[model samples]
Target: MRRRKLLAGLAATAAAPLLGSGSVQADEALLGELLVTRLRDAMLGLGTAAAAPSSPEALATDFTRALADFDACRYASLAVRLPRLIRVGHALSTSGGDTEQHTLLAKTYLLATRMLVKMDEQQLGWMAADRAQQLAQSTGDVLAVAESARQLAVLARKAGWHDQALSIALSAADHPDLRGTGRAGAAVRGLLVQSASYTLARRGDRDGMRELTDEAAALAKELGATLLRDHGGGFSPLTVQLHRISAENHADDPRAALDAARAISLKALPSVERRSRALGDIAVTYDRLGRRSDCVRTLLAAERCAPQETHARPATKTLISSLLVSGPTSTELRGLAERSGVLV
Candidate 1:
């Protein structure tokens, strides 16, 4: 009954905007709560798998589609697919000792962790990350393991465990299996290093953050192209610049963040997710610098880039709320807050 209610609510939320309800704002917090609960139940082995067993080949195709939805910032579609995918992936992994099944399950859980983190469900995020790490290690895939570690690091950092987050990221970056594994290995290593650098920035270690950022940039340069691996993707110079925006923002260098933002263009990013993320960073940085008009404009641009991300991400919602009550407002800002379901 509870699961059905939650799923129904999610369905309505996803459909409300598309149903010509121009003034309706989906309750993103309610959506997150429902999703986290559903995901937690699925992770606890409480859900029934599909009646018919799916072939590994079939499951692979489904997973690829789900991943594409994630990459394209189709959060509504991805959220609807994730719980069932996790259940099926769990069933297949337990049915046999197939490393491929385990790998797929790990990837599923890793994707769940990412979503949970974006929604700021840190406790559930931790659970998903732990499961991903365990399953990835079981597969003996170094890149998979490194990706899981990166997610874990992100969760830890969000939970205020800065040192632990840094340790996890740096350790994964230095993993022996990742060494000399060519471009793929370098890409994963770059992600880990970038994650660690952000952790350092969060800890107020500006110098350390810059040093590690440079290291990650070097690896990105070596990759020569934005390698879109099964992992989180975007291990290129552009991505490094994106990360720099957030890092500088964290380090109380809003000017530097804006400078980094100037180096990026939405058209050059690999996916809508990255583009919206970049715009969100720029928006936040503008808020930091008291550029209210710029902040609102950038946030609107982010909404244009990926409405799902702008409407559903917790940080974006908070920023909208902040803009609403911070002082003078505009028609566009109010409309954005209304669309994002931010309570004024």
Candidate 2:
């Protein structure tokens, strides 16, 4: 009886954060949270079991589910909850007899944490990335470590540390394990090269940037990888917008940048938040190209599509402000604002 009570107490404690009460909609949220909580607990239990007698396959399953949840709720604060789970997963794989499993798990954690950082949850993401990097080194997982270094490079660039970003990116590109690891997919290698190239370009190493980008593009073509596929041409959607922005920076023709932005906007329209962001970017690109009419039209379209949420209002306002800034506004712009019921 005591044991049973103790187990029940542990279960309730684990589940408390996910449980809520109120109306039907609240219950749905509670249910979703509960499901995520239960998955997290199961992952913990699997890790414990693996520690006793390592089971790489079970650990992989648990990590996959945890990853899915993390990806789904990345925009929220749920990304902060992933590092501990990743640590347990890394432990399970490293302790197990499967070298492949160890390498993959370590790399996945590193990549996922990097993605979380790009989502603007920098602190938690960096902590997780740093932890994954340490674990990868401990396990002699050089490829995983290189990948983590690449992530750190990108983060440094985002934080305005251009020189540091360039150095780290070069290091990632030159890592022996990264060059030698057959386990790492071609797409991953392409991204690493592409990132290195972009960083070089930002640092004004034009020849180096061209050489690297050319190499990356050729490799991507050889691997049958699209340079502008969904989710930034990688497996994750985290860098989709960033990739477009980078491509625009390097594009010789303004139309190329406009095309890239349009592609992203088309891909993002299914999600309200992403749609608003993509539209705003498109408007900015048009403004940069001196296409004031195009900019105004796009902004008007964005305002119409934007949801009435507090988070979306600011972006809407910015678009409106931009439309007003380009003097001698088009009748089409005024017509759009009036028709969309935004002119009050």
Candidate 3:
């Protein structure tokens, strides 16, 4: 009986160690996973908390962070971060299940969708954008819905689905709920005009593009929404884009085109993508003006701003080639091309 008791005690002692080791292993594994998750969340700029207040200042801060990431060519990071932040912001705004929260959520989702679209993740963008639209509709938030529709239109355009873009933008414009709200209606109309203009531009219809731009500008003025007058968005960068496009259509006046392009380039230095686009435009304008040295310099600046690989790469390459042809001997241009690695 003593031997039997001793054996049982030994078994218990062994089992205790085994069980403790197993438990420790399990805990260690869980901790590793948690560490990984937290790392990923940090890389994406997400916080552990929910949302914050809906003040413009708060929104602006969020916007600034997102924009900074975008300008730094951190598209994937921005894509992950903006959506999470926006979702949290929505949650905070609508914690009480208020109609205002619902509206704010829809808008935040729209911003998230835009970031996804910019990152070339169309499927996810469409899903989120559609969900935002549904939420806006449920809340009877016509302005929010209109903005959502406009974002969807942009996605469609980027995907080369011109018809879809037009339909969505026009639908937003015609939403009955927006009719009474001057600012909202005007904004929707501006989107429609911008959509049409882009479609026409893609089809190489210069006259149609001009007409739409004029119409969009007029409507924007009427509503006191001058932000989109030069382009679709209400920011200096978009304004630069508008000026550059205008210069493109006025080939005969190379000086005017160059002036506009230079202005855009100067204004876009802080933004990588915008700077690349502006530099490309400037190079093209300089080429048209027969300013060989200036064209080469502008092309080189553009090359510096471009991502190693981006949706804008092909266009940037074309601009480089045009500037090269207009500039110094093929040797210098070839050296620049090799350095950029954009042209073999």
Q: Which residue window of length 10 is worst by lDDT in model 2?
A: 19-28
Question: Which stretches in model 3 have alpha-carbon errors above 4 Å?
Answer: 1-80, 86-97, 221-225, 228-232, 235-277, 280-296, 299-344
Model 3 poorest ten-residue lDDT run = 20-29
Evaluated at residue 242, the lDDT of candidate 1 is 95
lDDT digits (tens) for residues 272-322 of candidate 3? 655555666666667776777777777766555554323224444565666
Q: Per-residue lDDT for 87-204 in model 2, tens only?
A: 4555655466466665655655564554444344455456656766776787787656766777777777767787888788776766666777652445566677777777776676
Question: Can you give the TM-score per candidate against the true fold?
Answer: 0.89, 0.56, 0.57
TM-score: the better of candidates 2 and 3 = 3
True-structure lDDT of candidate 1 = 0.81
lDDT of 1 at 17: 41
Sorted on lDDT, highest at the top, how do the candidates line up? Answer: 1, 3, 2
The all-Cα superposition gives candidate 1 an RMSD in Å to the true structure of 4.5
| TM-score rank order | 1, 3, 2
What lDDT does candidate 1 reach at residue 305?
A: 85
